[model samples]
Target: MSSIVEIKLSADQTEGTKATVAQWLKRKGEHVTINEPIIELETDKVMMEVIAPVSGVLEDIFVREGEPAEENIILGTILETAMSNPSNEQKNDREIRAEETPKNVSNDLPRKNPAAGQPDPPSTFISPAVRRLRQQHQFDLSQITGTGKNNRITTRDVNAYLSGSMDQSAAQNATYDAAAISPTAAGSEIIPHSQMRKIIADHMQHSVQTAPHVTSIFDLDLSAIIKHRKSNKQAFAQQGAKLTFTAYFMAAAIQAIKHQPKINSQFHEHGLEVFKHVNLGFGTALGDEGLIVPVIQQCQNLNLIQIAQELTRLTDKARNNQLTQKEVQGGTFTLSNHGVSGSLVATPIIINQPQSAILGLGKMEKRVVVEEHNGQDMMVIKPMCYVSLTIDHRALDAYQTNDFLSHFKAVIENWQ
Candidate 1:
């Protein structure tokens, strides 16, 4: 006799918090293999996939798209049965379509299921705005590529496809005219907050409200580090790792933390919780989608090259929306390197909570400075950047904060 099994969101998958139903990977009655992903759950920090517990047919869905789901929530059910092989005709059709599809199309785009002999249903996760746009343009969801989390379609993706299909000059003219129109004259848009955005907003507000923030800024001379990287960057690149300034900064931070262990600590109700190891979290901006911090655990033990490799891997995963939950959690210290986008400095960068302090690195620029050379003052151009440490005043005093920055500056300035 066939048995039905409940498919629930694993408690450990989301750290016991609520998540939004991002998408359903399989439709009802769809055959699924053991451990195959059946649904996606979008939490504040990362997108998590809920996989099937056993090989079976997806029998029913208990949760709808975009709805809040608690930990261990029964999202669906599966009817246990032996997997069936696809017919030759269905398999041939899928292969033909795969060959015909453009190379530029996302591999995650929904296609005909070989076993079912039918195109996968459009995700019920489509936003109202996207649905309206799709209907207005008479475009099928499968025809447009999704660039959002988990390859979910966004309104911008549809608009880009439509713009590409139009004449170049006409598209440019339309974009110009749209920008020229004021929101008051042409109806302002009211976009509902995305789940991720809402969570970020709440978290930021809570952090600001909870902590008495104090910021200390220092300027660092990066001449030695810059020269060192310039000399060895090519050698590092040949080994498949791109040596970046952030890596050097991360290494410097680790060294600084080693000198002052209190910097790599968190605030607790009874007392300060000084961590023995550094779980470094670096901020990665995702444009309008806001930022994510993917942590490099036990960073205290990693060398410069290893730090660079981890930074590159995490940044790539962040941009590609491929980061996991654990990759973003358990951070004891946070760093925000906003300089890459050309911002000179940002003071009082809010601390990522529980962590007592957060570091911010600003733009690196060449500046003329007077320095003693052979007992004579000489003017020379040096690479300089601004760094800030925003600390929770309740947990850290100016002495500890300033000492941390001093150690960090010393490490950067004197790098060999």
Candidate 2:
């Protein structure tokens, strides 16, 4: 006898946030092997694959492509059939991408109920793909009964409508026509925003709208830390550490944050939320795909050597797209070492919202400066860089910002 196995996105999987169905890898009636990836879900931070739980033929697709997938919903189903020697199933393109997926990205959304005490407002999911299908066919989607969450119209509904399988009801539901948007000119190339880029843009825009931003700049001499790195680099390399300037900057940040604890805080209407641990996040550029901030947790407990080791590991993961959901979250503070890209200084680097501040490092270059030697003026060449701290004005001011910068400078300049 054949049995049916339902594919469900568990509550813990979604983490109280919606994941868009980026694509459906298996079609209805297609055979699927156990532990095979059959779907891709696009979350705010990563792309995850939902794996098949049993060996069988896909019987149905409950959530179509380009629809919001919610917790406790059946994504699809498989008709389970008896298998012989299933263990010998060779890995194929259908193999589980467990290393890259099975991830649950963290969010500030409420754990129990995202709505909290207030009732949620009415909203519907009308996807870009569905609208484009409508634009191409001139079919009003209201003619079909929706099977998606909250009775939202989905791509499957449009398909049924097109195939004359749905009611012929007619009415234009004014849904900002995502399909009607045209290009700037006839031949201009248009690349749709990647899921990561789209969410990042929303995050940035939201940060700007929610926070009153202010920036403070300071110039620091890197001679001491540069000397320290050069002296210990070989030893660090022997111990599997990279001895990067980023490691030094992060160590300095920890010292400064310890001296000025208020700098490691998040803003709230009730009060300022100060954290005891320094969980640092740094921007890792992914070239054309945009950058992702992979956080290193509990820096207050780690030494310089340990920090360097972790920096090597996480940075490798970020660049190769191997970072886990947990590896990219729980950051109480952020740093942007934009200097490596040859930027002299970047003012007002956008604050990672909810967090009060973000630190910016400028390019290091040799510059001439005047120094007093035995009551005589002398010119000396030194390596220097401009450091900037951008803070939310509501949670911090020039006084505190300067204090943090001062301590940061002291740590870097006097490193032993």
lDDT of 1 at 303: 89
Measured over all alpha carbons after superposition, the RMSD of each candidate to the real structure, in angstroms, is 6.9, 14.5
Query: What would the TM-scores of all predictions be?
Result: 0.74, 0.68
Name model 1 segments beyond 4 Å from true. Answer: 1-4, 16-18, 28-31, 57-60, 79-187, 348-352, 368-381
Candidate 2 Cα outliers beyond 4 Å, as residue runs:
1-19, 28-38, 51-63, 68-183, 186-188, 348-351, 373-378
- The lDDT leader among the candidates is 1
| lDDT by residue for model 2 (1-416), tens | 78999998887664443478887766676667787667767666555668799997888999987787887788889988776533322232124322212123222233346657654322133444555676676765546565433343445446545645433332122222345545679876344665567767777888889888888899989999988888999999999999999999999999999999989999999999999999999998877667788889999979999999999999987765556666766789999999999999997455357889999999999999899999999999999999999998889988999999999999999999
Write model 1 residue lDDT over 95-196, tens digit each, in one string: 544553334555475766799887554333454455556556666567676655446565546666776676976544322334454455465633445677
lDDT of each: 0.78, 0.76
Worst 10 residues of 2 by lDDT: 98-107
**Model 2, global lDDT:** 0.76
